[model samples]
Target: MNDKNTTQFNHENVKVGEETSPTLLRFFRRKWLGIWQSNPPGMGLFVFGLCIAVIMAIPIVYVIWRSLFAGIDRWQRLLDERIPQLLWNTLSLAGAVTVSTMIIGVSLAWIVIRTDIPGKKAWRWLLAMPLTVPPYVGAVTYIIVFGRSGWARDLWQSTPWLVNALGDYSINIYSFGGVFLVLTMFTYPYVYLIASASLRKMNRNYEEAAYSQGMSTSEVFWKVNLPLLRPAIGAGGILVSLYVLGDFGTIAMLRYVTFTAAIYFQRASFDTASAAVLSLVLILLTVAILWIESKTRRKNKYYQTSNTYRKPLTLKLGKWKPFVLFYVSVVFFVSVILPIGVLVYWSRIGIRMGALDGRFFGFAINSLKVSGFAALLCMLFSMPIIYLKGRYPSLITKVIEKLSYAGYALPGVIVALGFVFIFNNHLPRLYGTFYIVALAFVVRFLPQAMQAGEASLSLISPRIDEAARSLGYPPWKVMLKVILPNMLPGVLAGGALVFVSAIKELPATLMLRPPNFDTLAVRVYFEASESIYHLAAPAALLIVLVSVVPLRYMLKKY
Candidate 1:
């Protein structure tokens, strides 16, 4: 009887051990393998994402590698002379622009979406229209109107009293104040769009709850709406900050010294090593901004737990309607109307002066060719990256998605510099080709493509993929036939964004284009920089017109 009891006890112990072993194995698998090991399909995506990550990382890696080997002499020189001023200039501008955009964007978005101000719908489009005008283009127009030699100055000179009173006190468009104003005007749209969308989608239950608890409208906004809008505001602020950080054209045109302009000058002087070092520092600043945004975003998760959708009630601006209208009008006038009006005025001048010659046609065609190719490539590459990130949730997918945005934050000049090193050393034959310019566009604007693609793909259900597969349609066919049709709108939107961006891109085209290969942007920059406003006006006008294609799409999407 004792022997039988002991044998039974040992059998029970063995059973218990067997039961716990699988749990331990699963824990280890989850800790180590993550999503890649759990789903069989994930392995393939993991490899694909890894490949794309490596490709996307090459430029950043090249910049870092070059910087490290850029001898101590270059580093010391930069530290002593250039880095200090550049750091102060870059950071101050980025900080000021980020804060200003957030204020303007968030305020305008609230007025449009939440207030029953007259013409709210029209205001939405007008507010967003500024995005179509590149900041540098806006700077050019502002310079034409407000610079020392601008219309305002000329007009003041014509008035004896005004001229005497304001002698030598004309607005200087080449100062820090000018850079801040131009950047803010063009970039606030980023914040406005995001905030408007967030406000539109916000579940009113929270606000209602706050109201029921005896909170006033002001209190409700402060206690509930603003907190919920944090993520959207944070995202928009990141974009604006990154834009300010990476801006070369606007700052250069305005004659402000920042890292981007410094890098361009360094590269022009064949100081590639010092340029790399500056680029590395710029990358660090970008990374820090990204990190802060990530932390802020992660601190709160805003989602509706219920599936009920309801439109928010617009607040009646009974007494404040005129004030609100004036505010909206001022923003639109400064950002869109003035710029386009000035361009149109100067374009007519250019036409009269025969500035639209054969070379002008060449510039237009070159712009179309490079922008078209870049847009196509962006749409093509965005597919797989968006597919993996959308259909599969995994560590690898997240990494690739983040890696793809590196270019969006880094200056175009830095990207051009990286390619300069890469092509010169590895593929000397391809160094001066137009294709290199297209590649630079692809790198700089891929994030826009990815954003559009991911938004479209997220609306699709995975069950559809399974159903197609079960119907004996292979993965490729399912993607090509079923997915492509549904994704066409988003793909086109992405392509349009890339096209607009490429057309307006200044630094990359300036740096990478072959000799005598001028795009509209290049010609505009050259003519405008030389103070030949009439000659630059036509190309700048064309760019703004092309940019309008995506504006309608954005109005609908947001």
Candidate 2:
């Protein structure tokens, strides 16, 4: 009996073991298969997105890592000697620019949107035209008009009474004040565009309610309209602040020292470790500003909850019409007319001097090559990520989307520094090639492409994705064959934007361009620095013209 029981127990154990083993194996197999088969984004799409994200993230990651191990002495030395001044300069400039932009942008947006200003249509586009001129180019224009040898200086010197009164053509375009003025002029458009849109869309109920309570027009404006504009104001403020932080060309050209300028000089001096440390600090400052903006935005939720939407009435400027028109005209003239006129005048001189000769054409061709490549890559890369995000809506997709914007938030100098460390250390073959510069451009401007493409893709229904899948198209194939064709206009527009931005990009190109491989932006920077206006003007003018595409795009978008 004992022997029989032992054999039965052994048989039972063998049967249980057999059942458990295949069950576990099947579970594991199904889980593994699910990654490839259970979703719209199959293994291929997911891997491609992952690869792009990793590449996007690697430079930033490398910079952070490099900074962490850059030696405590280097950190201490920079912190004591450099960090204090840089922090003050960067933060103060950012704050000053943000505030000035807010005031100007909000006032201009209000005047255009709420008041009965003449030629509102013309005023709208003209006001936004400054955006077409890059701040650095604007700086150059201001320098031409206000620097020691500028037209203003010449006029002041030539006019004896003015020179005696103003004391020696004392307008220094290389000072902090100059940087502030140039940035404010170009960046106010950010606020103006957004605030104008918000003003237009704002529900009339709140203002009417305020009026019913016997509130004055001025009171209603302050209490009702201004409160509603906070979100737009916050968004514009963040943009301006971030731009100020990342600006290399404007700040550097104006001879004002900020973190970006300091980092560039450090890198130039071969102090890579110190540069990395400084970059990390700048990154922290950027994060801090973004965080504060976020916190402020979150705390103030001004949603127009009423479903009944009515457009607000446009107020007659009455006796104030002339003043308002004058203000608008002056803003337009200073921001748009002056800078562009200078470029055109100088360009005419440049052309007369054979600025569009073989060498000029070569620079133009070089600009086209790298910028075109970057734009194409951005358009191509943007599709998969936007596709995955729009369709999948998973954590992985969200992370990928965020990673792709890493370079956009980073300053060009920092991005260039990251690429320098990465390429010099690992990608030796591509280290000094224009390809690296193109890639950096891709990183820096990919978000612009993504935003445009995502705007287009969001309008598309997932049913289209489903139908394509039902017809046996894989996710990748659907994106390529169906989605891409539908979204091609927006994608192309996005590509155009990237192209313009890459064409204007200065610091990254400066850092990454191969020796003797000068593009238009490079030529502009070097030529302008050396006071070679004739050479710089053509490229600067071309860039300005190309930039108009985005201005039109923004006008439509806003």
Candidate 3:
């Protein structure tokens, strides 16, 4: 009896162990899986997304890493001789331009959106048209009009009265003042577009309340409306400042020496170490400006919570109508009409002189080839990132999203510099190839695609993703089949934006292009530098026309 009972007990124990074994195995698997495995994104999708982010970030990371080992001697030399002057030039220009743009942008937005400006609808789009003209192109026009041998100088010399009044045309187009003016004119549109949108949506309840408290119209504007517009001003100011900081072509064309110009020259001289050092400083400066903007933005948060919101009443300009109209017309003329007119005139002259030759077609083809390829790459690369971020909400996805924007924020020169270091060492096969230029563009503009894709994806319901999964689709497959089809329009719009930007991109293209390869931007920069305005004008006009694609998108968006 004892032997039989002991055998039966052992048999029961074995059965219990078998029953609990699967449970223990599952528990260990769950712990091992953690957040990623528990999520919708499988291991394959996660790895793919991470790889894309790493690739996007390689240029910036490589630049920073190279800068650290640039040697104490190189660092000291740049610090002692080059950096201080570059900082002053860059920061001063950025500051002056940002403040000017904010003032101009906000004032114009207020006039158009709030007051009874004549033909407000016409003025609205007209004022924003300067954005269609790249600042570098605008610089070229200004140089043609105001340079020493330009039309202005010719007119001044011909007219004794004008020469007597202005003292031999004392204004230098290459001076600090000229750069500030050019940047401010072209970039104020950023503030104007955003502020106008903000003004249109702003609840009039605050202004009405201020009036009810016996405040005058001016008082209400000062005490209430201006305070509300801080966010818009900050947003626009940051854009202008960032543009000024990263701007290479305009500054270089105007003969100003900022960090970007310095870095390019350093690299041109094959002093890679000094270039790295300057690039590091520029990166830090960029980080500092961004940090300041973020802190200021966080400290000031304004929200409108009203169940019964009303649009603000338009104030009649009364006796000030003509003055307001004149101001608006002047801005439109200088910003849009003048630049376009200059291009047309010179282009007409050029067309007669065979400016659109076989070489011009080659340049056009080259631009389209590289820019189109880059746009396609951006569209493809951005999908995985936006999908992973939107579908799988986690620390990892958030990081991947941020990493994609690294190139967009840094200067193109720094980006190109990073590419130089990377290709010279690890990517020699791609060095000096047009593929490298396109890749640089992708690194620089992928964020644009991700942004547009995210906006469209937000409108999509997550249940669709779940439904697709229920049909046995994996995460990657679901994004490919369902999400992409839904977001194709936004993706294309983003691609259009990337295409326009890549075409206008000068610094990176100049640095990365292989020998005997030139795009329209490169052509414009070179032709303009050499005063071959006939050749430059045709390309400049083409670029300006291409830039209209983004302006239309901005109008629809803002």
lDDT of each: 0.88, 0.91, 0.92
The CA-based lDDT of model 3 is what? 0.92
TM-score (all chains, Cα) for each model: 0.89, 0.95, 0.94
Q: Candidate 2 on 1-558: residue-level lDDT in tens?
A: 999999999999999999999999999878765643556477798899889998898888999999999999989998899999999999999999999999999999998888889898788888988888999999988989998899998888889998777688788889989999999999999999999999999998999999999999999999998889999999999999999999988987899999999999999999999999999999998888888988999999988865799998899989999888888888888898899999999999999988899999999999999999999999989998988888887767889999999999989999999999999988799898889999999989999999999999988888998999999988899999999999998899999999999999999998899998999888888898888898888899999888999999999989
How big is the positional error of residue 36 in model 3, measured in Å on the Cα after superposition?
5.2
User: How displaced is residue 232 in candidate 1, in Å?
Assistant: 1.6
- Candidate 1 lDDT, 1-558, residue by residue in tens: 999999999999999999899989989878755655554343454566567666666788899999999999989988998899999999999999999999999999999999988888788888899988989889899999998888988788788898677675468899999999999999999999999999998888888888999999999898899988899899999989999998888998999999999999999999899999999999998899888888878878777755776778789999888988888889888898999999999999999999899989999999999999999988978877887777666787788887888777788988899999998899899989999999889888999998888788888888888898789975556666888789888988899899998999999999899998999998888899999999899999999889898787787787
Candidate 1 lDDT trough over 10 residues, lowest sum: 37-46
List candidate 1 segments past 4 Å from native: 1-50, 164-168, 212-214, 302-310, 467-478
Q: Of the pair 1 and 3, which is ahead by lDDT?
A: 3
State in Å the error of residue 487, model 2: 1.4
Task: Pick the lDDT winner.
Answer: 3
Q: What's the lDDT for candidate 2?
A: 0.91
Q: Which residue pairs clash within candidate 1?
A: none
Tens digits of per-residue lDDT for model 3 on 278-344?
Answer: 9999999999999999999999989897688898889999999998889888988888998899999
Worst 10 residues of 2 by lDDT: 32-41
